[model samples]
Structure formats: C-alpha cells, structure tokens
Target: MLHPEDVPTLREREHGRNLEGCCGPHGGTGPNLACPCGSLVATLLADCLGPWEVRLHPLRTWAHDPTGA
Candidate 1:
C-alpha cells in the first residue's frame, strides 16, 4: 500500500460506482483508480472512516527501487 500523493500517475476511476465514501473514495467495489493508459491498477481508500491509502494490484504493477538496493 502507498499514499495516493506518492503515486501521482494514478487517476480517479471514470465511474462513481466504485468510489463510494463519506469524504472520498471508499475503494470497496474494487480498483477505483487507473493508470494513464486506462489500466485499472489500484484501489484508493480515502474514506474519512478508514485508513487513507492506495493498494496497488501486484499482478498489474511493477516496483523499481531507485536507490538500487
């Protein structure tokens, strides 16, 4: 999981059915964010009553350590 601000490439889902929340997206319906290429990649949990975070789909995502650890 990562902060939404950390992953600026993700865009809000086109539809609202997956973005139900009190203040922001609840991300309960499934992946509520997409890549610039329109690929569903993560679920953004920004609901006021829940932990604010973005859960990336592992199978659909890649990790590159800039520090080369």
Candidate 2:
C-alpha cells in the first residue's frame, strides 16, 4: 500500500512516467533523489529533516488573456 503523502504533486504530461518514478521506484520523490527541477525537496520533506519550498518564476508570456481584451 502507498501512502497519500508519499506522492509528488507535480506531474508531467509529456513524460510517460510520473515524477516519482524518475526519483526511484517506491522512493516517492525524496529530496536526495534527482527531480525534474534538479532539487532535493522531496527527500528533505520525507525524512523530516527540514522544510522545503519551491518558488516558480514565469520567464515568458506565451499566451494573452482573451477575456481582458
């Protein structure tokens, strides 16, 4: 049985596999594991050694809001 908290919220549609699998089988995206972002947020949180926070900055505007126009 898998724990609900042991899963990564970020998911990739293009990749046939989930983020959890990339980290390692049954590893549940640990901080020590290599994530798509190349960070170890998962492992730190899982081990309860420290808190993890990720901030995403929008680099570019690909689309415009049609409703605003």
Candidate 3:
C-alpha cells in the first residue's frame, strides 16, 4: 500500500512531469511530454505492483450472421 503522502493527487502540480524532456526520450517532445514525470512514476509503480495488464474494450461489429436465417 502506498502512503498517503507518497501517493500524488491529481490536484497536485509537483507530481506532474516536466515537458522539457528530463527522463524521457530525446527530440520531438516524446511520450512523456504530455505528462512528463508522471510516466516514470507510473512505470515505477507498475513495476513495484507487478506487471500491469490492460484489456481493450470490444469494438462494434457491423456484420450480421447470415447463417442463422
């Protein structure tokens, strides 16, 4: 469990990453540009908590089953 103080709130500005490219890839304002430090922090958190798994929501299917008719 993360400590209350250690866990950053969305309202906090200090927890956000810098757009200046500190820890992220060089040039063209990479992936971290939008959130900056948040990416690194999130990576660390994911590592500590074990590998993260993401499930994509199903997309709409336009084709209907003709065999049923």
Candidate 4:
C-alpha cells in the first residue's frame, strides 16, 4: 500500500543515512515516522529492499505517554 505522496518523505529519510565514513561502518537511518505512516514505510522497504531495509524505531511522543513513566 505504497503511495506516491509518501515516497518522497520516505526516500528523504533513507538518504539521511548516506554518511559513508562520517558515522558508522554502515551508515544508518531510522524510520521514526508518525503512526501508520512509519510502519508502512518500514514494511515496504524491508519487503522490497529497493533502497534500504528501513527498521522501525519510532520515538515516544508525550502525547502517547505524558507521564514518561
């Protein structure tokens, strides 16, 4: 269920990890996107491997856990 509207954003996030030697031996990018958007993109990349195997590691928003407990 990939959409043209999201392709650009997902691709941009992937490119963020193209730091050959600046970061790690194998640069890394995160799929810390919002809700279903991030999950979908990660699955698509993992299944297709068209660019990178997007790993889902979404950030915890205060809205979801205001107590932070």
* Candidate lDDT (C-alpha), each: 0.89, 0.34, 0.28, 0.36
- Model 2: pairs clashing at backbone N, Cα or C within 3 Å: 30-42, 30-43, 31-40, 31-42, 31-43
Writing each residue's lDDT as its tens digit, candidate 2 over 1-69 gives 223345465333234232344233333443233345543333322223323332222331134698998
Off by over 4 Å in 2: 1-30, 44-69
lDDT of 3 by residue, 1-69 (tens): 233234343121244433233342222222221123332222111223233221111231133588977
Q: Which ranges in model 3 have alpha carbons more than 4 Å from their true place? A: 1-47, 59-69
Model 2: lowest-lDDT 10 consecutive positions: 53-62
Candidate 1: RMSD to truth: 2.2
Q: What is the lDDT of residue 52 in candidate 2?
A: 38
lDDT winner between 1 and 3, please give it. 1
Residue lDDT tens for model 1, 1-69: 898899998998886668888899888788989999998999999989888899999888898899999
Clashing pairs in 1: none
Task: Work out how many backbone clashes candidate 2 has.
Answer: 5
User: Which prediction has more favorable lDDT, 3 or 4?
Assistant: 4
Per-candidate TM equals 0.83, 0.19, 0.15, 0.22
TM-score comparison, 2 vs 4, better candidate: 4
Please give the ranking of all candidate structures by lDDT, highest first, separated by commas. Answer: 1, 4, 2, 3
RMSD of 4: 9.9
Query: What local lDDT score does residue 53 receive in model 2, on the 0 to 100 scale?
Result: 35
Best by lDDT: 1
